[model samples]
Target: CPPKIITKSATYVYKLSFTALYTVYDVTNDHHMPIRLKDSSNSQKTRLQYASWVGDTNALAMVVENDIYLRQSPSSEEDYRLTFTGEENTLYNGVPDWLYQEEIFKTFEAIWISLDGTYLMFASFNDSKVGQMNFPWFSSNTVLTSDKQNDRFFFPASRQIRYPTAGSHNPEVKLWMAKLSNFSNIEIVELTQPAVILGRNMQKKHQ
Candidate 1:
């Protein structure tokens, strides 16, 4: 008997099968092939948070260390860096922040690939000005004491998370579109809010 090939949900572009490993389905030939990253080191893999196929093509986009990386194919060594403002716990590209995940998108993704696979649109978040809430977290693991009468205690550690309270500074968000091409000079366009919306926001601030 032949091996069974299982596929996941179908996007606007292609039907992808993501299980233990990321696989790309070739529509033209109707076959499944495993995708491999150029950098497969543990450190690089650790930094990678999200990765997905771009449209109906074999091109791939990954969110690594809050930055966006694009490649022509899964095995391409010369990948393109779409964003550069990704900083730890401050700025994020191609992925939403905590507030957006919980309130706006209700998903972990903030990217949209064109059906033709020629363009990529994504959102960036700047949480640098947002206030962080710090609190103590008690660990579940028990530590044994070095004494005749053995005793166990849980250690408390300080935890911090960026949060936007009412009337507080919220995360700055911006939408961007990039042209996916073979050349090194990738054209990126910023999609700004309309004047009407901007004026309404300004009016609300003044009130």
Candidate 2:
């Protein structure tokens, strides 16, 4: 997407649906100042993050619906789907999972486009084995929307997030590097180092 123009004079940011007028599936020409595009598919959040033009390059990358999309240039009619493992509340690409977001990366996204835009490095987290933690939230409601006949009163609500505990299965982290030449190619590097165990265990893996 083209960089958004900031109007410092009457500074205000607003969310509007651009898909109504122009669609990525329909457009071809890139106008001056480039137009920012959005994912046409309806999503739970309907929002994207970690969007930026590759450092000193014409390519663009963004996280939409927990999946990463890349384009050779801003003028590209459609973006290439770099990852397909992203599932709703499950697998994520270029973005950290719940545990990593909370305790690991301590940041929103876990992706880095190279300074020269020749390569991209990212972290992939597998939290399928991790357990979920739910916090109780008391709410007073006459009828729960999900329940019919208004039979339920004072429904219990809770917030659930994946959190690892002692002796629990920690999220397995993996690193991957992708080169621009082969857009679909991704190589995984296993950094299986038992740094905590200061002896033969660490040496064995390195060897």
Candidate 3:
């Protein structure tokens, strides 16, 4: 299904206006609506829970919910309009997925408009090799082809995740930076030392 479209307006005058949009689904009806708040507005509304935004006073450096989206402004409207598909890769800007944020502890994965609100930065995780495991419990105690007995069945294929433990090998980590003006000019920063550990200890002596 196609995404819904919505419009918002500002209430107060400022250098910029920031707004956030969220979607709320109606479990009873299986429908959704978009929620938005402009700079001048102080109240929040409940709507579809698809997208959210945090904009600066001037409406610049607006952090969108998803990665890729389309922005438009009608010739008559004063504020810009946003429409997005539900895909994260296309709409969000700086946020990473669950694994990258939780497992890797990467909190600041996104870079949005510099001090001047002219540039943006974003990071991505590529864990294509990760695998999954599936077990069949209902088939337990059943007899299969030939002499095979099934008490518990494991899937023939399993997913392998590259996780690093205290003494395990870790994957290579790299940092990338890009200018909003020219996304093609991405710079990759390599670290000479990939891993580091810090610890603290306390000792007390009786006087």
Candidate 4:
């Protein structure tokens, strides 16, 4: 079967003029409509980064500017903040830090929803002890003439991100799970050694 495309606003909503309109669209049937999400009172509502839909429904697990937000249902408007320690370069929530991105996971996101859609497991990386790396990036589009010798016109911008190399400090990684009903912290994943958990089985015990 081929996928249907929305060519006009009559078929699908192309634009909307409203503040705090987080919409969810379902296109399984005809006359696809958008469900507007309710907004939270959190003053810092930035753009979403790692937005993921849970199971086969409209449940949304999203990351906005590194913090995790959960919406249990499509018609619900309350956004749940699962983790609160999401500083730019210091701490990460539901996502891997720079060290895990470079050394372990090799990706930005470090989260996975359970198969039954009742739980979510995500890794938290605390890089407060790790060092930093800095570099300069020159824009390829900006034209730099050799005739002009002024250092100010060079526009060499400094780029910085936490980079852990070799045997220095690594990110303190820990896994956490939260229930879907109230988004409560259920269990903490830990390993005193490899291939072992410090507590009871997360699957059987938490359920």
**Which ranges in model 2 have alpha carbons more than 4 Å from their true place?**
1-46, 137-156, 182-207
Candidate 3 segments whose C-alpha is farther than 4 A from its true place: 1-66, 70-93, 106-109, 133-178, 181-207
Q: Which candidate model has the greater lDDT, 1 or 2? A: 1
lDDT of residue 122 for candidate 2? 75
Candidates' C-alpha lDDT: 0.70, 0.60, 0.34, 0.60
lDDT of each residue in 1-207, candidate 3, tens digit only = 333334344221111222334443445666764443242253655222123232221222223443322112111113332223223322233444434555565452443435543343444343333332234333333544544554444434332333445564433233334333322342333223333321222222321
The Cα RMSD in angstroms, rounded to one decimal, for candidate 4 relative to the true structure is: 9.9
The model with the greater lDDT, 2 or 3, is 2
Q: Give each model a TM-score.
A: 0.73, 0.63, 0.33, 0.65
- Candidate 2 per-residue lDDT, tens place, 1-207, comes to 434312112211112111111112312344333324434543322235456666677777766656777776756676777777776455667878776776657676778878888877777777778888887655455457777465766547776656789999987777777677655554444445466775777678899
Give the local distance difference test score of model 4: 0.60
Ranking by TM-score: 1, 4, 2, 3
Error of 2 at 106 (Å): 1.8
Q: Which pairs, if any, clash in model 4? A: 38-77
RMSD of candidate 3 to the truth, in angstroms, is: 15.1
For residues 40-106, what per-residue lDDT tens digits would candidate 1 score against the true structure? Answer: 6533322345677777776778776678888777556677788889987789888777778767787
Report residue 45 deviation for candidate 2 (angstroms). Answer: 10
Q: Residue 56 CA error for candidate 3 (Å)?
A: 4.2
Evaluated with TM-score, which candidate comes out highest?
A: 1
> By TM-score, is 2 or 4 better?
4
